[model samples]
Target: MSLSVEEVRRRVAADWNGIVDVLDEKIALRSVSAEGIAGENMERSARFVADTLRKVGVDARVEQATGADGKPGAWEVIGEKIVDPDAPTVLLYAHHDVQPVPDPAEWNTDPFVGTVVGDRLFGRGSCDDGAGIAIHYGALEALGDDLGVNVKVFIEGEEEMGSPSFIPFIEAHRGEFKADVIVVADSGNWAPDIPSLTTSLRGNATCDVHVRVLGHAVHSGQYGGPILDANTVAAMLISSMYDREGNLAVPGLEGCEPIGGLERDVDELGLRADTGVVDSYELAGTGSLASRLWTKPSMTVIGFDATPVKDSFNVIAPECTFRLSVRVSPVQAPHAALEAIQVFCEEHAPFGAEVKVTMLEEGMGWAMDPDCAATKDAETAMAEAFGTAPVNMGQGGSIPFIPELQRIFPDAEVLVTGPEDPQSNAHSPNESVSVSGLEKDVVAEALLLDKLAHKPEPTNL
Candidate 1:
């Protein structure tokens, strides 16, 4: 039987306290997966997620993965509830990993020790994905045992570490995670009060660049005038990635123009990023700010290995390395974009310096088709839950697994929505989720599942 919206609402409210408790329990575990950080907490968190799902009438287990580096990777939780074989299936995705807490002092409250301040719940992973985990479980509880549709839940354990093992892990368990529609609860809405359906996302490619100008270090004071310095050469190459107006200078990359109704406040974004831009500090790139951020390709020098400012010597460095992160447009293929970046760097190196680029990680972007019937149903659900129509928005950030999921389930309609808002501050210190926002997500997802279940059987891919 199809559950009514009122039933979903009542179930969400009734399970509110229990949902909060689950979120708090997750935040309390410092499940970080960065280098030098422990993975024991990640494993524990994965187990916790699996156990929680088991209590909600789902069969769940934690599966260990093999990392991209060919070593042991983090653990992931996969759960399934099959209502009927012929019913449409919905795959819910979220991550259990949290970013490393760089400094405990930076957080107003203990990052792992969550605190409720009025409408907000503050903690690491509180909004980023912890809220998502709760939303899926809460929605299932609302639907009861006979959901009218099959549901599959995937809670990844190393998303914050860039999801290096995502493809391999999903490939290994392809049949178990198959579904007709995928809902990725990992992105944010446009604002705290406003909900949005993420329609597109940027792709990304990363590489390490090495510039060799000299065979060995030379005395800067004696040979600095004529000989080239690897550090200087590397900086110049990096600088060439941007134009005088700070737009990406790489040629042959494509960009999609922003849809007519999408807009974001520059000041609000600056405040969220904590980057105080002066009035005259013109925004980078061309087209609308939304287009520039979400649709255009951009580059960032994420890391560099040169002489440290604290331990600098009066010598010319022999070689320098810079890690380049290229954000590709949703319409561009990651491999092509990565190759362009490599070719551009090698061709533009200054002073005939030897340049080489080693590709690190590359993933394609995703865009939802506008004519899908599932999208209309999703839009209606979001509108009903938020009391306003959801904007078809584009996210500047990339989710590596989203595109992979698209490839794995070619006919599935991928809907990206989450409890996060601009103020959630995900991945930053003091991350939090609105108590009301989470409740709304539970309502929307539960309604979406119910609505889709009543539709005609899904078409074959």
Candidate 2:
């Protein structure tokens, strides 16, 4: 059975109040899954998700697995709504864990309470994935019993911590996670009225480089003129990675030409204000702003080790270490990029300083088919809800698990979507989700489900 636009909108409007209330309740859970938080919070969050799924006729339960570290993984809410024994199954994925609030004082409203101010809801985890949970819940509520396909609701509890047990959990319960389509509602949108179907995600890797100039610290006035400090040598190493325009000068780390041709104006997007960059600061790399943000490679010094000002006594440092967080193209292998960085550091050793490289971590990038049957149906549904076609976009941030999921289920159509907009400051102070935008997301998803149920044939560009 096909549902009309008017029907979908009416149902969404009727159920919106409960949806917002559920999102608010989730935001207050404090289900942080960082390195050192208590484990009970994750369990509590899992229970909450399982209970919510049951309300919508899903056979849900809480499950957990052991990680590679030989410890318990975060609790995962796993369940299913099998409308028919022989129908296609769609998997709804979202994370209930949140990034820890760095400083509560930085927030205008309480970090855990979802407060509606004007058109936005302000709180931690308000948009990042809380809205995502609500969208999945709201769609099921709107569609009631005529769901075209079966659904498996997998609400993870530790996505913010890199999904350490995700693969292992799948290994333990692979059959339940299988589906024809997977909707990952964890990325962002282009605007409140405009949707963004994320088609690409950059891969990520990190490394630490150690530079040793002197065996031990020495008086600056005595040896400073003849020798360079290790700190200064480390600075030289960082500069060597970029050219005059600040584009990456390293070879062997590949970057692809821009895809989708989606141009972005930095000023209108509030890029400067979002980053709190200084006035007249020139942008790094060469290309359209969209290309730089999505398709190109970027490396930044995330951590530095050196003497502090309070401990400074005008001494030439003996050795120093700095960490580099690298973002590479979806098509490039992260290990290859990390190897290139290591080779560059060894070759460009400033002043012949002894160098050591330790590759920290790496995650593969991903690219999705924009012309698939499910993608076309999603575009049609989102257009009907928002009165405009969704833009095909790419996110620089890496999800890591998407690649693994695709590898396990090669034929499944993976669609990345979310309610976050440019103003949704996820992982920062004053994070929020636009109320109107979230409602649109619910309607769009409900409509997409209706289309997928009826149009099961494959379509391509």
Candidate 3:
């Protein structure tokens, strides 16, 4: 017997506690894959993901692939359950790893513990992608054996580490992954209550710039007057990336045009709590709020190396470095944007302070064809699941693996959907997901899968 959408929703509601318990367990894994850390619990998390999928009726297994650096990457939980040979297959994708907690003391609650307070479930990966695993599980469990389409699951374990081995792994096993539709449960909605289909994603480009101003260290008290310190020169270079108005001044960088009927009347004041901006701090940049976040290039000096105030020294440093992270427009190439930044940095060098740049990470962005038949179906499913009209939105974040998936499977229609909200604060301390929104996400995915199963033949569907 085919399970109805109403039945799926009811099952999601009935099994909400189980879903939370699974999420909490996943959170407790400490599956952090960041910096050079290989994530101690990555294999365990992958096994747990595979077991969860197996229990839910999917034939799943844990797999791993060697990255370009010849090092083994994180474990991948892969499986498939084909209902019909001729039916279109839908690929369900999520990651099983979480980000490292740089400092647990900054969090209001334990970063590895899924603490539920009111409607929010707080944890490091609760909203980012751990909840994503639960969403897929809930949908499959609720649907039972009545899916109209085949399902393939790929739970990545190194997504938090920029998916270093994603390309090689997918290419090595390319034959195992061919789908008519791909659902990426890694992006969030417009708001907690507003359901959104992520239509575009900004790519990322990063580089570290080093500035040298002195040949040797000197006493600041003795040589501070005539010559500027290395830290001061590095600050000047950083300042060149933006204008006095606070907009990024890097030339040749790209910005996407605003979408029609999609420009939001942003309530900056209303979002103060979400942003946690300090009092009297004004927002920067130009253009619509949505455009600024989703389309245009945004740059920040994420890390700086200089002197430590506590380890104070009267010495003038000879060199300093700052790492710049850029989110390029979805349509712009990450390499191209990075090249522009390199040129801008060289040309805008202050006091001819021997500036040098070293490229770090670069990733291509992705955009979906919102007019596709699968997208149309997804909209209806989300609308029904949430009882409100859904919106097509763009995420400012970068999902490097997505564009690669599109490139490999040119025929598949990819959908970026998830349970995160603006307040989720993914990748930061006290990260969380809205409990109610997450429940709706389960229902939405189930409904979307059911709709795809019953759709017409795979003709750009």
Clashes per prediction? Answer: 0, 0, 0
lDDT of 2 at 227: 91
lDDT of 2 by residue, 14-130 (tens): 988999998999999988888432388888888888888888888999987678887877899999999887877899999999999989999999989999999999999999899
Give the TM-score of each candidate. 0.89, 0.94, 0.87
Order the numbered candidates by lDDT, best leading: 2, 3, 1
Q: List the residue pairs that clash in candidate 2.
A: none
The 10-residue segment of model 3 with minimum total lDDT is 257-266
Model 1 off-target regions past 4 Å? 1-4, 34-40, 66-72, 216-228, 259-273, 278-280, 310-318, 456-461
Task: Kindly list the per-residue Cα lDDT of model 3 for residues 51-118, writing each as its tens digit.
Answer: 99998889999987687899877789889998899988999999988888999999999998899989
Better of 1 and 2 by lDDT: 2
Query: Which regions of candidate 2 are displaced past 4 Å?
Result: 35-38, 263-269, 456-461
- The superposed Cα distance between candidate 2 and the true structure at residue 186, in angstroms, equals 0.6
- Judged by lDDT, which candidate is best? 2
Instruction: Give the clash count for model 1.
Output: 0
**TM-score, prediction 1:** 0.89
List the pairs of residues colliding in candidate 3. none
Global CA lDDT of candidate 1, please?
Answer: 0.84
Q: Which candidate has the top score in TM-score?
A: 2
Worst ten-residue run, lDDT, model 1? Answer: 259-268
